[model samples]
Target: MQLANYLFFTTGCEQALAFYAACGLGEVTELKRYGRDGQPPTAAMEGKVMHARFEGPGVLFYASDNHDAEPMRGSAHILMLEDRGETARLFGQLAEGGTVTTPLGIQPWGDYYGKLTDRFGVQWMLNCRL
Candidate 1:
């Protein structure tokens, strides 16, 4: 299992993905439009990313667009691990007593990843290589 850390901008997820891809980070493995799945997203979320993943070095970063769902405010961001099995274990453990923002699964970027907030309100990011 491998782990990495990252800070994703809350808004402008798509723009950020493109910028990172252009900066030689790695590649935008997945970029799904919010309203493309037949269940169209709200008009305000048309261009927003339902899910996005970017790879750099041995790291995979995940981000999502902020619709009118909720406001996320904090200064913490980290891409935890890059190992699938280990990440799964950690995600399960952390979510056991906390809240999971994103369940561990194959992300749009072709990697296994998830997000959650620990019982202490600290956010975490888990990612594993595809």
Candidate 2:
């Protein structure tokens, strides 16, 4: 298992992803545009971000547009991990004392990752690099 941190953006996911990339965070991978899929997206989500991934030294982050236009709140950044074994170990430890939002598995981005919030309400992200 490997893990990476995640951030959820409200609408301007593409811009945010580019900004972070410009900030020297890491190379942006899987920068997807919603309507670019060649499918008819909803009228409200024609050009939004369907998914985006970024990588930096010891950091991996993901983002997507909120289709509902709901406001993103709270501080829910994931704690990305580098090694699958380390991620699995950490997942077990955290789940033992918290809740798993997403079970570890092969994500659409072709990486193994998971999400969980510890007992203290702190969210964690685990990832295994592909």
Candidate 3:
């Protein structure tokens, strides 16, 4: 399975998207607004992104706006895996003797995904498109 990076923007995703696009990271391949999901954003998150994906020759970046999120610090990267089998295997290995914040399972977003803090104290996110 191939690996990709995912990002989360507690706020200011629009500006971040613009900045990265201008920096030539890649084109904005897909964008989904919160309201488009039939779940309108609150006043603070109005016009903000529910999800945005950027793609380049060897890069994939995903981001979303979180209006009520706590101040983000450090890296919030998700290690995205493309194959379900590999994702499950690696997630099992990583969760061994570690904390599983979210059990591996199918999510409404059309993927099998999970979150954990590995034994080495590193956070991880494993994903496989369904």
Candidate 4:
């Protein structure tokens, strides 16, 4: 069985997408915009992301602009990296223009972990088993 993670961006898909891409999360593919398909979105939602996916090594991330839907309430996404250097780099990048709830450091479990909520209100758990 396969599982995928999806995010509903009420009004900030583009910004979040750009940020994730810049963080080297993965390649954004299959980006569909509103009005491209039947039942176009409202004017305010026009050109927004109807659906998008990010593909990386063993990763499948999905997101959409939920202009008409209820706003998302939480960030349930976590990213795990194997390399300490890469994890540190990404941790710093993700922390840019965001708040770090938990600073990156060695955990008692013999791993490195940190928590942050990005500017777009997406919480992230960065874990590295060094």
Each candidate structure's TM-score, on Cα atoms with residue i matched to residue i, is 0.46, 0.50, 0.51, 0.90
Residue 27, model 3, lDDT: 77
Which of candidates 1 and 4 is the stronger one according to lDDT? Answer: 4
**Candidate of highest TM-score:** 4
Which stretches of model 4 miss by more than 4 angstroms?
68-75
Local distance difference test values of all predictions, in order: 0.65, 0.69, 0.70, 0.84
Tens-digit lDDT string for candidate 1 (47-127):
667777778775577776765434345643455565677677767765656688888899899888888875434476777
Ranking by lDDT: 4, 3, 2, 1
lDDT of 2 by residue, 12-117 (tens): 6776666545544477777777789765677777888777788877667777776654443465665566678767876776666578989998899988899877
Q: How many clashing pairs in candidate 4?
A: 0
Please, what are the lDDT tens digits per residue for candidate 4 over residues 1-25? 8889788888788889888888888
lDDT, residue 84, candidate 3: 89
lDDT of 2: 0.69
TM-score (C-alpha, index-matched) for candidate 1: 0.46
User: How high is the lDDT of residue 129 in model 1?
Assistant: 78
